[model samples]
Target chain A: MTSATRRHVLQYGLAGCLMGLGSKSLGATTSSGVTDSEIVLGMSAAFSGPSRGLGIELYRGASAYFEHVNRQGGIAGRKVVLKTYDDGYQPDPAVKNTLTLMLEDEVFALFGYVGTPTVTRVLPMLKKFQERQIYLFFPFTGAQPQREPPYGPFAFNLRASYRQETAGLVQNFVNIGRRRIAVFYQADAYGRSGWAGVRQALKQYGEQIVGEATYRRGSKFTGVMRDQVEILKASRPDAVICIGAYAACAAFLRDAVDLGLQVPIANVSFVGSENLLNLITQGRDDGERYTALLVNSQVVPSYHDTSIPAVKQYQELMALYAPSAPQELLTESYTPFSHSFVSLEGFLDAKMMVEILGRLGETPERGALEDAVFSITEYDLGIGEAVSFGPERRQGLQKVYYTVVDEGRFVPLHNWQTRFA
Target chain B: MSMPKLFSMPRLFRKTLFGVFFLFGVIGVSTSLLSIYAVDTHLSKEYEANSKGIAKTIADASVNILLNSNLTALQSLIDQFIEIQGVSYIYITSETGEILAHTFVPGIPEEIKAGDVNSTTTVERSLPGMGDFIEVGSPILAGVAGTVRIGMDTGLIALKIQRAIGQQIYLICIIFVVGVFAAIWFVNYAAKPVDGLLNFAVGLAREQSSDGAKSQELLARNDEAGDLARLFLHFSRPTDGHGKGPQSGPDRSKE
Candidate 1:
């Protein structure tokens, strides 16, 4: 099924029944996951497989902030504890893990979910149990399912949506006279979301995507991507936009370089740019130059720009706590990034969640969460940007950043005209 | 293998019944063998050709994926082909001879992995627990991309042959039962008239030329037996006690 941002599904919660596992789960006194001493938040993200970095790094960033907060004796003397599960970036497992989180584990809320496909499938489950006042807070996706009308009420987003990112990329490409754009995406809900974004953005300029190719989800870096490259190369587009995970995107980039499809390839934030860079370049000066014509769109600013208060704080807390993936969920070993767009977003999500918890006072209740978040009409997130929420505004961020590889790191691409022109 | 004279009928009738049964058996067995052979040969070819076609398709589709070194996509590509009925397994190897993707559970069988990896369009193999298979392999991009191997179940063809043979045997049995019923009906029609003629001759030997009901019944018959009885009556006088008729079996009249 195609993943549309939002529809008017009444009771637009999520898809599964909590088996009546609503407020009744915690009885008449308090919420399900919160006790007098600890506020437990449930998270179901991709902790294994190719997309595991998204889950591991996001969890690490958010939990580092939570750990630091808990050290200072948590909000109003209540510690924030995260309960996590690994979904391997698959929809069925995501749905199953979410049910266990809400029903079996009975967490206070769902948080830090990694992928669009997983969150989209779990949206109906939330819609199914809306009366229980179950809410998903600041999941790691910018897809419309969590931001639009139907399922928007159940989820709150901290990062800019993929549509916003794509709109920015498309506008930038056209501004530099690179209008014939093509797309290489995974053949699933997540890919469809990014592809639709590009299409809608191009329509604003009276143009459309010149070509498109797709690969199955969960493709690895070792895959052959010449077929997809060939399909798009036939259209002879000036630029290509990619919507896929790091491994598959790396393979596509590798094959594109080998097959001589020399055009600027752009990836959205979900591609895990640092991971993509590592897979293709392998940290050796082989002079392969896979990044010679690559651009990436991010919802969060560069973590290297410590001048921003949030970035500085995120780096400090991440180093001080040095959070790691849950030992049980560590199916593979990945060297943690000192700074990345994904982890920064997760840190901000945690910061926002703390602000919400602090507003709830000592005796926190699940029913008061939405109203409390909507009350924040003015707040400085230290990111040099205004972060606010209202009854109508579910997303807290609306900014997108563009970056290109320089000296083996992603630096902001401030001069797009000089490069693409 | 011979049926004895168990019925109260003439020896000639028993001989005719035995001959009919033997002929039916010979024809029935021959037909069964011919049908089994035709199905076995034809189905084997069909399965082999179908497997080769499937292997070639996978090889063509996999070139891009293999060139990209995408084992996951290659596996997914072949997964769609394996669902076809005769396909039991599928595996792909890269140009460098490394196993890229395989549909084996608990890993590929040790025999196939260590043995001759080279396979033509059709290679028959009995892989222990894997049953019989007719393997078909096709090269992608003329061996630049690698090879796609598909193993189709030969046991399925054998099953079809068995089913065909079973139907033929059932038909043969039905004909044999019909023959037995027809033989019983023929014995009743021919044997009774011959017995009547023999009884009349035995009575003439004792000077009892009186026209009994049995004699009258034989004469009233419309068959050749009735003509023979009338001819005997014309040729012999009632006083001629030395009446003649062919004698066969035990003569109970003397006893």
Candidate 2:
């Protein structure tokens, strides 16, 4: 070969080799859990544990939306599928399930993770694969840890935080001229988050929690309620804010009534409103009177409120997708999960996800997904108010609404001033 | 009693020593400076990343507190964050430009309160009490609740850089001293053969018989001194009628 020809060949060959190396170092973009005809999302939540009502209802609701979209040929002609793993509401199992979903199943995202502890445990693992841009979207938690830095980048929340719920609850109590407030909390992240929110809220009125009692996380009464009742009775609080699972809170309330510690009680939306009501009314006298003294803070509008577009859509869609499910059902297990606030929230979350994904165009990736979500500015969710986000804002909802049980059904309280008036 | 002249270094030896000093010194100083710069840049980036992370965290925790107008809890959180090393100050302000909770003394500046900090903002400023610092600000509930800002003291980073530079200087000084000793040994070893050639030439000039052995030893050497030794021996020998030199002269054309 001529000298010039050899030189040219070497030059081009070296350049090509260097370019290949550069691309390798930059890493190839491999889209996981996505295909031409389908996009799969992964979820790890309690499906066979004490918190089963919440996880099952939430999943069913979101799935209902997904099914509805699938019937309409899906978003951009790609059918959405959800892959769920039952973690029993424990951190270790949740971690294992998440790893399996991410590494083995290769899911697009960890969508709708259920509990605060489970989400907290999954956060460090999320950081390890930050480059992959695989985020946990719209987890069913309102804990502050996931909403903060180091974990904020990994997860996005759609619901109002526990802080908002607790603040609303506490503010209403204070406005009604109720002092000497006590807290009954479960000993875990979820309970503590609610407690912290209450403490933070009460600080504004120059009041502090007069009494406090605790139970183990996920405890089912199991003799812990009697001691808590005794402590609460001793404090003689005018009102008690309950931060716990539905069963436990119901047991505590029942015990409090038996001990003649007659007082008004408040609970956050995460307490499983339907489940709590079922537990309170089952095999009990004075159920209506006891129900009247209870108040719950909800992040979403009432499920029966058809005046709202989202609520009407939820009801119609529920009728179509979950025809057998009643508006509210209390089964033999005493846990309730049929057409409730939790399910409504899940449905709303799915709607938002679908909207963002559709706007992302076909073959949506992680960066584009984040951009679409963060760029949302006062976008209507078919609910009364609009939801939004920003570069520093990850959560979408802010308002907290209050509800009280009346004649075996939840009815919205008009306003905080009404309680005092 | 005076030191031998052989111990005294020549101009070439001095030049070689100076050259080594300048070259190694430049290399050492440049390497140290580059390393210092690289490490400082890396650390500064890490600090900035951490600052942003902290600011975001505080903002997240502040939302409900701000919404509830719980200045006491917000203040407690700010005070707790200030206890972290390198954190100089933290503050929160409502959306309507009211200072809710803060770690600032004499309250937040009016400009900061009025500033439209929509996203995570970072600024470097010098002020009284806190000499030089990096301030990071983030919104809690944008256009809803409030915003949070944190300040990090730069003195800690500067101290880290200074310590790194001091260590580099210490190591480079040791390398320089060792290099000086090595340069001395090398100069002596190289000049030994040249000195031998000089002695052989001087003996030949005085027509001393003892110079023959010394000149032969010098000629056996394979260095530049051997060539001069051979030339001196040739001129010292008796010339033939044909005006030719000694036939025993070594061939050095290859060299």
Leading candidate by TM-score: 1
The Cα error of candidate 2 at residue B255, in Å, is 99
lDDT of 2 by residue, A1-421 (tens): 2343345336534643454455456653225666555577888777665677778778878888988999999988877877667676777778887887787666777898887767777887899878878889888878876677656888888899988988887877877777778888765556657767888788898988777777755666334478778877777887899887877888888788777787778888888888788778977677886676788889899998899999998988987887221112212142335588888888998998888878778667876778888878899998877889876888998988889888898889886455433
Provide the lDDT at A341 for model 1.
82
- C-alpha lDDT of all candidate models, in order: 0.80, 0.75
Minimum summed lDDT over a 10-residue window in model 1 chain B is located at B246-255
Best by DockQ: 1
Best of the candidates, lDDT:
1
Q: How would the docking of model 1 be graded?
A: incorrect
Off by over 4 Å in 2: A1-30, A221-224, A323-336, A415-421, B1-255
